[model samples]
Target: MEYPDPKRKSNMFGKLLMAAAVTALCIIMLKHSPSFSTPTHFSRHEKGVTHVLVTGGAGYIGSHAALRLLKESYRVTIVDNLSRGNIGAVKVLQDLFPEPGRLQFIYADLGDPDAVDKIFSENAFDAVIHFAAVAYVGESTTDPLKYYHNITSNTLMVLKSMAAHGVGTLIYSSTCATYGEPEKMPITEETPQVPINPYGKAKKMAEDMILDFSKNSDMAIMILRYFNVIGSDPEGRLGEAPRPELREQGRISGACFDAARGIIPGIKVKGTDYKTHDGTCIRDYIDVTDLVDAHVKALQHAKPQNVGIYNVGTGKGRSVKEFVEACKKATGVDIKVEYLPRRPGDYAEVFSDPTKIRRELNWTARFTDLQESLGIAWRWQKAHHNGYSSS
Candidate 1:
């Protein structure tokens, strides 16, 4: 047999060994990555709430929050009309609840007095998280009646029902739109609301109703003024399912969807002439998961005086162009570029002060990076093409 030199043979063996070691390391890394490993964790248990009622619990943000509550051992009763929400989100909860008896779902709208009455009569909820509202600023401008009727009047009805039921605690989904164009850089909870649009006005009206109800009745209220709510469940469970007619920018998953389908040949930017580092609108985007945690904290605070308002957002403003660029990098998609005129009622830059939420509730936003949140959202969107409704 022809034998090679020992040095050459040793070199060949060493190369094979190195390649095997590298291969093993890569496998370990891939297993721990978000693609393979779950990003969500069941952190803590909720010992206080005997029963918590969630209105619009089947919707985008509501559904995820409901899931978190269930994981934390809270008895949740979801009241939804299923008008804007998906049944798939509900079904996921149906399966996960260890004891189905603890989970109750009332298929009723806040508009119906009888339905609202029935929910109040049956369940003795310790807290109520109201996510039920018609939330679309542009559409609200055109259809003010619908906005006012549903968001305002319907909220009044819910409050009346809550009062009747003696539900002492309430958490409302308010909007950063309530601020409109701010005189200052970052919007705080103390800023006097000057809503330029009907949707913002509607939210403000509902907030007023809630506050009024809290004053008159024995109710504690936490009004969460949300910025741009983006991202989805880290486990591909739930995500944004915006109304097709009212869907807008800020959510990178939807933009990624457009790129994946080749509907947008390139990134089509709406406006690029605004006064910012980039000539586009900047918004503070918070992850749906982090937002869920804030709601739980608000619910936990017992005393009536502890119930106050807080802004739920990343606190960092991300411009529209910057977000798009992040999407391109994350998804490896060449998003087309097309600049048009600026959207009416669009603020140049709207971020949160974030001091109130941290100081009051002792809760700080964990995911400050927009790209990471968007990355999670993009992956969830890629897997569930039809959104949470389809899942």
Candidate 2:
């Protein structure tokens, strides 16, 4: 038995008090911090750089997904045709990781079989995220072959190249439009796919190809059929900056932005006689940032023996009128509304169940608030009024 020294006891008490004070401070800071929908905290990957190939990497979704990969400490190679992609956005990605051999850009079109093959020959890709395809519904309707050829034919070329190079993992960017107008309110993956538009038809054809490929070969694929994607990088590093020509034919948020900046006289409420509460179409507007997070999760969970299809959405529908009102609040201007009859190929209300992704991938849409998403989008539009050209 030994008696405790007075000095030792005093030091021990002081250390305990200091630790308690620091823990209390941390708790207070966390309580006041702004909240974001977050995944279960863990290392995103094991140690090592994953070399990923991102097709159409200069486009809005592709670029954000590439950035997300870079943040996860992956080596990224971006290939784009520049026909409808952004050069300025590519520069932003390169600047984020200036170190050599970390982020590389190749100006090539997958439509060219030779160019696609060349890319696979030169680089050893651990995985591929495919985002190259014609997405304009209006244009697809006018020139259906263009959509079919680009989405179906070009996809075969890419797949052939991947098989030749032994790249077993892929994450395909699909759209909810593949489901068309479903009788159910919140659709599940098992919902019968009956696409009504050429754009949707093109994507569905590509999906069928991917599934067939998976059955024959030891290839893993995650086809994410997402709803409308909006917002920018919350850090202001990246955002949606489409080419000027596609501005009017853009998604709802971009159209609303055009109205805010006088690019268009006002926004169009495409339908106002639906059975919904507001007599308008309801859609799931998932944030771009959160959407990309799902991509990362899919990439991590992919295996050559696995083939999965998940709908990336908030599982909650926001009406057209609600989004317009949200835009007004975000931009601090009354957005002029032009009511119009229902557009062709438009659905009344379509959202996702989102249960599979949440249960499997542990992902959530933190920035699901319409006003908040619009506000983030408005900031980017305001900063770059002419889009990347303004830069």
Candidate 3:
């Protein structure tokens, strides 16, 4: 039999292909319209377990997020260099999960490309919650190189690794340090980000890079600029068990715990001359769990080629003296406070508006009551007096 006209067949095929393309594009627009902007159907794993990579999982907030993730039924892989992280936090998590694939820990640094490569290759992660960075403002100012290398360079490495591994979603643990002394009372996401110190500068660099990277790729990036992150797991299990030998007794809440427990002579109140209700700095402190909940929500809201910048806090500013007073009341001890000069790069009064994260993510800091959160922290510190020391 003679075949039909080849040109006619070709034209028919072209018409069918055009129709399919139009249908797909219509579906895309429908899904992405303002009404469907908030996707109810989230990305998932083959076995329905969303695998997440938590860099710096042995550190303070990282560990807490990891624990929260595991509880939320996400498979977690924790990577830490142990430079500033304590293995004790990992021990606590391992004791709780006690499963191989459910929760795994890798002793690696984000600065090491080879290490990052191995991690991304082995684990099929659906998302990455990046908490690995040099976090001390004073230390970042003194050693700017370390901050740049760790925060900026290391974060870039993580980004590249995720891109290579085809992981498109990232929950970046940023800081209000990027805001750098906002002139306003409650800092909004639109506040001017003029970092005074190297730490904030490094974070700003990373944020810019991440935003720029998303411009070229299909990555979904969520940058949570955290204010003062205080409080523990509330169950006294996962708290700020910073390495005691490292002397992480400088954080306001931790210092209060130490002073109350006599671990430190007194909680040093830095900068008794700032322009605030009290002569000390004011910061918006959010519970670690609440902060991680925002992370989780960001992950849920993530879409291909999406970028979200949010200020994570309770929106209420608390002064240093007020925090000290709350600590005293929480621990039932008159914690001594010694006034000291304000360190460089210190913001006069920094808090959050939180209206964006609240309206969008439907999240609010439920456990941000200063005294109540401090009470939980005091209990944790009192129990783990040595901060998970083998001694």
Ranking by lDDT: 2, 3, 1
Show where candidate 1 strays beyond 4 Å: 1-49, 243-253, 263-267, 388-390
Collision pairs in model 1: 266-336, 267-335, 267-336, 267-337
Q: What lDDT tens digits, residue by residue, belong to model 3 across residues 1-391?
A: 9989999999999999999999999999877553455422122245687888999999989999999998988888889998877899998899999865678888987888987886776567899999998688877777899999999999999999999979979999899998887667688899999999999999999999999899899888899999888888888787886656545424777778877888788877779888777789888888888988999999999888889999889988888888888889999998777898988888888888999999998988899789998888878877776777731
Every candidate's CA RMSD: 22.0, 19.5, 12.9
RMSD of 3: 12.9
**Candidate lDDT (C-alpha), each:** 0.78, 0.86, 0.85
Instruction: Report the alpha-carbon TM-score of model 2 versus the true structure.
Output: 0.86
- Show pairs that collide, candidate 2: none
| Predicted structure 1, TM vs. truth | 0.83
> What's the residue-level lDDT of 355 in candidate 2?
91
Off by over 4 Å in 3: 1-45
Q: Report the CA-based lDDT of candidate 3 relative to the real structure.
A: 0.85
